[model samples]
Target chain A: MELASSNYIETIGFIAAFLTTAAFLPQVFKTWKTKDVSGLSFSMLLMFFVGVFLWLVYGYYKESPSMIMANTITLGSAFLLIYFKITYRKK
Target chain B: MELASSNYIETIGFIAAFLTTAAFLPQVFKTWKTKDVSGLSFSMLLMFFVGVFLWLVYGYYKESPSMIMANTITLGSAFLLIYFKITYRKK
Candidate 1:
């Protein structure tokens, strides 16, 4: 729980968190580049979009910068996907 | 920001969240049933597992039960996938 540890191993979790999370950067980048979300899962994105929004609010309530920052980026990317989802919806 | 309003639309976010997230249940059940995760993405899981773990801690720090419960379940499911990833290592 003491992720604040000063040791290198202590930072592994943070590194893991960052690395794993940054993995989404590619998806975000590609999505931004193409603005194509036909392959993305609408149901999945819709669900997590709200979940992340709630978490963003929760983070605000708690005043945790780490949570706030991550969730914000997550929200942005998720919203983009959701927007594309709505845009490309079948008429 | 007012998720506690108790209106159906207010609850839509929660329901959307539950449904979209629960969408993973089928994959979890399938993986559990067959113990086959070859189709799952290891890099994706690893990235998400650590991300979810950090989120859990962040949720705990914030004393938000909603965040805690959801992230805990996500972490558990992600860990299972991670286990499968390590287990099925190409040795």
Candidate 2:
């Protein structure tokens, strides 16, 4: 029973991780394609980058495979957005 | 020894939670202040909302206080952003 319950929780975590991490892709694609960053908040991207980085560290220390996987992908996406925000800003 | 290490992990989680949740504020503020939806991706906001909502459910099932708190706040913010995107798009 306990094992089954834990498995259920892991499934939920995995789905949650997948959704949240994949959520950033559209923004990345839109920003990349449009190169219109007027609406993007620099501070938000910076803070999110730092926060996701911390989450990555937290996941590592917690030994959570899902958290680690989610945050790693999220960290990369956040980095890409940050780069987009800067690189496209002057154009 | 284990307790101390666990506490340290908790501290990291707490900070990560605070940062990730708080990171949405500037975007909210910028959107509210400028009423700019051009740079905001509707698809991204929608996906983020669903993802955060799922994270909330996962947090509840996992009994993770930090996860619950962070996702709750993020969910609210994501919802607000979506609202802004829809409401301001026609303007």
Q: Retained native contacts per candidate, as fractions? A: 0.23, 0.72
- Clashing residue pairs, backbone N/CA/C < 3 A, model 1: A20-B47
- Local accuracy of candidate 2 as per-residue lDDT tens digits, B1-91: 3433767877777788998888878878888999988777787678788878877887677666777888999998999999999999975
TM-score of each: 0.61, 0.83
- Listed for every candidate in order, the interface RMSD values in angstroms are 6.1, 2.6
Q: Is the docking of candidate 1 incorrect, acceptable, medium or high quality?
A: incorrect
* Two-chain complex of model 1, DockQ on C-alpha atoms against the true structure: 0.21
**Per-model CA lDDT versus the true structure:** 0.62, 0.81
Interface DockQ of candidate 2: 0.58
Identify the candidate with maximal lDDT.
Answer: 2
